[model samples]
Target: MPLPYFGLRARISLAVMLATLLATVSMAFAAYRLQADETRNRFELAARTSFESDLKQALYQIQYGPVTDPATALTAYMTREQGISWALLDFTSGGRPPDLWEGGYRVDAVVRRDDTPPVTLPEELVDYARRSYPEPVGKLDVDGYLVYFGAATDSLVLVEFYNMGGLNAELAKLRWSLAAIALVVSTAGVATALFAAKRIQRPVHAVATAARLLGEGELSTRVPVRGRDELADLAVSFNAMAGQVGHSISELQAKDRQQRRFIDDVAHDLRTPIAAMVAVVDSLDTADAEVRSRSARLLTAQTRRLARLVEDLLEMSRFDAGVADFRTEPVDLAALVTDALELSAPSADVELRVHGDVTLTGDPRRLHTVARNLLINAIGHGAEPITVTIDGSRPESVTLRVADSGPGIPDELLPLLFDRFVRGDRARQATEGSGLGLAIADQNARLHGAKIVAANDGGAVFTVTVPRGVTTTG
Candidate 1:
């Protein structure tokens, strides 16, 4: 039969209980069989010892001893063995079956015990002896009673029946006792199985409940570890997984907040330039030549500043969209840096040095943008003397470092230095620059399979190492 619905604990407990019950019952059954067989053997042996010798003596007197009647001698033996219900048979017609009697064979009875009723020999027992056994067999289990037959002479066979109601009652009581013990042992086993199942499933259930809670947005839910076992290892692994999930989600949330701030900063910066351009346009209505030229120049500068912010935003969007393709080709890294310096800060006090192979295969446009942005960031935020070094000393990489003797980055902003819209001096005018310079530089360096990091060693030092496999070049 199929069992009812059950959880893991119930299933485990039920399985163990069934196994225990089966084993206990099987062992009890085996013990009962062995004990019952031994007791029956001893019963038959005692029956033989008590009656076989005397039965032989009665037959000898009837056949060859004193001139005594066969019935009288046999009757005397039956009366002597009291308390044992027995029967004697006299096979007539020379012990042959053809004229023995109807119903296979029939024997003349000699039950001479007058104190009790006469015992009738079983018809099936008589027939069995007529066919297979010419003489009485030692013992015969006839109809659950212990019966014995012995042939004292060719024509005279002695039969005995054991009154086993008392002994049968005792054996019945023993069977019940063994069954009771089996039931007790099986019940105990079931109880122990239930306890063990609970012990194992408790922690597993805790982990499952905690996982459900975690999925429902209780990110801090955790299970307590118990002993040193596989379950404890499961708890440790689950806690580790929960920790990593929490960390990744926290990072994503922070990045989301930063993106919102970037949009706000973009809107605020755009407003300023637009407002300045509108004022400059109103000023352009003046009649004086110098003032009109000055307004025109002011308008152009604000427009260019707005254009650069828009361009940086578009570039960052491309990176976020995973579509910024780098068209790589052979380029002189040192010359690119020099060109960027002359373009972005021609008159700024800066030191430049190139060492080892300064040639690499990369997109010249993006490289130029990276070099230009770093130099601009240094000039705008850091104090002189700014030092730019391109060191291709490593076999498979070239390092570019830009160091400026400026106040180092604030401790609060170091971890998020490469994030978008983060400025060195927040109070600086948006007209001075957009804060996407370093962020864009970092994106470009990473896109080119390069590593760029900013740190402070006596000043703000920005280092970028781009892989080139360069050994030597001019």
Candidate 2:
């Protein structure tokens, strides 16, 4: 089984913060241990020094001469050491201490007899002191604390009691300080971890947001690039990817729309020809010689229309597939527009309006094909008095504007007028157009790095913008 995945920022921040916390805890524990050991060492040294000095002084007093009372001397020495209590026993002597005077106030002391059985130190003392100290020492349990001290002699042993109260107070202060430091350190560590994680996570978050938008079909949304690092590279790559995907999808949609239009136009164009052919054949079968001759002509006319539609479809397909070629030449736009107008005069009721003279280098045949398609579409769909213009002189370029006074196209259908095999609904159901005239015109215009646009404010006007290129431009 796979382990569940966590976010990058959270995982990094948590791991770093936890490691820092653990290290701090380990250091704090080590410091506490060292401080405790130091405190114990200091107390042990003081105890050892006091025991050696005080006991030596008492023993020296006896060695010099007969000491008056050793127990009294030991107690007086211990009482001076503040909080230090001691007990001393003389294993040999059995007598009461001589009276000592403090300004006429007599102090009494008790001494154990030398012949009395000696008090045996506890076994815990023997074991602990033997392990903890090289010197002869004793630890007697007093309340809850173990008092550590040395015993000088079997006959006259001197031991000091260590007060646990002071040690406990010091340890409590240490713990409180450690706790405060840990809290401060932990807070700082967390803040630092969050700050670092945000710094690293910001770019990733932006990328994610952009991705979501892109998934929702917003191809233009892009991540804001920051540093010159991997994240910036990712943003750049993502933008490029979005552009390619958007372009491909747009192209596919356009192709699909074109295909649907092609099917509709083919069906509409075929219907009239097929219906006329049926009518003509019926007439030929039943009519006399003159009627049969007329029907044969009608049949030929419908066959020509069908043939024209098929040829247009094939030519448009060739252009779409990039197989169409241009035969380039130097062409005079002034004469070209005039000739195109004269040739279209037979079909068009509108008179061509001449404009400024222009000349260009181009393929005359393809350019003528573009002009014929435009003029034919205008005459076929529009009313009388169509206007055609030619502009550009020294640059050898041409601009043709064809306008008519017919009922203008609807604003809704104007955008799709140049698409393959698209015709007005009324025209598709009633008129006799192949619907490929404007489509072919638009394609030919694009073949020369040109474009065509339609407008119908007062009447329908089509403009074909083209450059005078000797070699067919894209």
Candidate 3:
């Protein structure tokens, strides 16, 4: 199964702290083991050396001196070693130790250099030593924690006991010290883990908080980037996302405002045509023939203007709703531009420049609308020299540019030139039609997998880039 889940900081702190604890404990355990073993080895070495030396001396005395002088070697040993207590067993009668210590022939008196109270060795222990005759056997006495080792020959056996309680107490202190050291180090590890986690978590927490604020309508929220790492990259990405979102929202809001203003303007424009048509209808009963004929013409003009406005409104709705479609077909680019010039601005002082046999696949009607709108905009807002260029030079795409030599588009309005109802030079846009022609043209360009870019090069320049080369079935 997967490990349990927790917060990032907690998980980080816990993992680091656990690793630290494990490493510290492993070191401490190894150190304690080595020290404890060394302490035990030191005590054991002392016992082994003293016992081997005294036993060797007693053996020498038995081999060289009179046999009755065996006690001399042991007494001399008791006088030499400070902490060692010696016991001698005589197996000449080939039996266990004597039950009595007072003048017993088989078991000699226990000899010690110190005046401490004596402990009689257990009978079972003595019997075990008798069975393990030659080899030295160690036993720990519980009362004084005396460590005993016995050695034997054919007749005489030497047993020695040394109290290890003081040494053992020192070892206990050492063990506690090690445990305390381990604990202190583990606590330090926890602190270090927390410190590290805080450094890492701070950036993440900032991003989280910023995201929350952004969601709550604080579009200006951004994260601070600190380092060239993954976390910093996340912060940078988040800040970029926030910026994009803010830009998109600002655009949406501007579009909404424009849409609202367009609606209001359309409503105001509707009354003029409708009132004129109603007046024409009201004058039908008048008998003056010239007045009736002029009223009839007024009615017809108002009716046509209203119909055109309604059609423009419907087209705008289609574009906004994303239902306007572009059906691709083989199109003659230069011929379409020439037709648009004649239909939209035939009488204007405009030049039509067709470059090569410009044939491409595109939506003819939409492409024509793009040309028609650019021509209309130029004639309405531009001056003497109007030029439309149909450039099919690039193998991958068809380019159309409609430029006019007039007082150029205002710098403030250039960015939003194609936004619906965004009319600059109020006198120029005072036509009786819906102000959605340029916006529709822009949308149609995008629908055809292209874009309309507007700039001011001496005057207003509108360039329509229609992507081609990639063949389409329909």
What value does the lDDT take at residue 326 in candidate 1? Answer: 73
Off by over 4 Å in 2: 1-6, 18-258, 278-287, 338-344, 347-357, 394-396, 405-413, 422-431, 456-459, 470-473
> 1-474 in candidate 1: lDDT tens per residue?
997889999889999999999999999999988888888778877877765766667766667756565655766766777666666666655443323444333323434333323334455665555454334565655544566776555555677666555567878988999999999999899999999899989999999999999888788988899888999999999999898888888889987997899889999989999999999999888899999999999899999999999999999998888888678788899999999999999999999999998898788898899999988888888778899999988788788999989887788888888888887564275327788888898888887787678898877899998888322111
Question: Which candidate achieves the best lDDT against the true structure?
Answer: 1
lDDT of 1: 0.78
Among the numbered candidates, top TM-score falls to: 1
TM-score of each: 0.80, 0.54, 0.77
Which pairs of residues collide in model 1? none
- Number of clashing residue pairs in every model? 0, 7, 0
Clash total of candidate 1: 0
Residue pairs of candidate 2 with colliding backbone atoms: 91-114, 92-114, 93-114, 94-113, 350-385, 359-396, 360-396
Q: Which residue pairs show backbone clashes in model 3?
A: none
Better of 1 and 3 by TM-score: 1
Model 3 ranges with Cα > 4 A deviation: 1-26, 68-82, 94-109, 113-146, 179-218, 227-238, 285-292, 341-351, 382-387, 403-413, 424-430, 453-461, 470-474
C-alpha RMSD of each candidate structure in angstroms: 5.0, 11.4, 5.5
Off by over 4 Å in 1: 1-16, 41-64, 67-83, 93-144, 212-217, 281-292, 327-331, 361-363, 407-412, 426-431, 469-474
C-alpha local distance difference test of each model: 0.78, 0.69, 0.77
- For 295-345, candidate 3 gives per-residue lDDT tens digits of 999999999989978887888888778677667789998888888888877
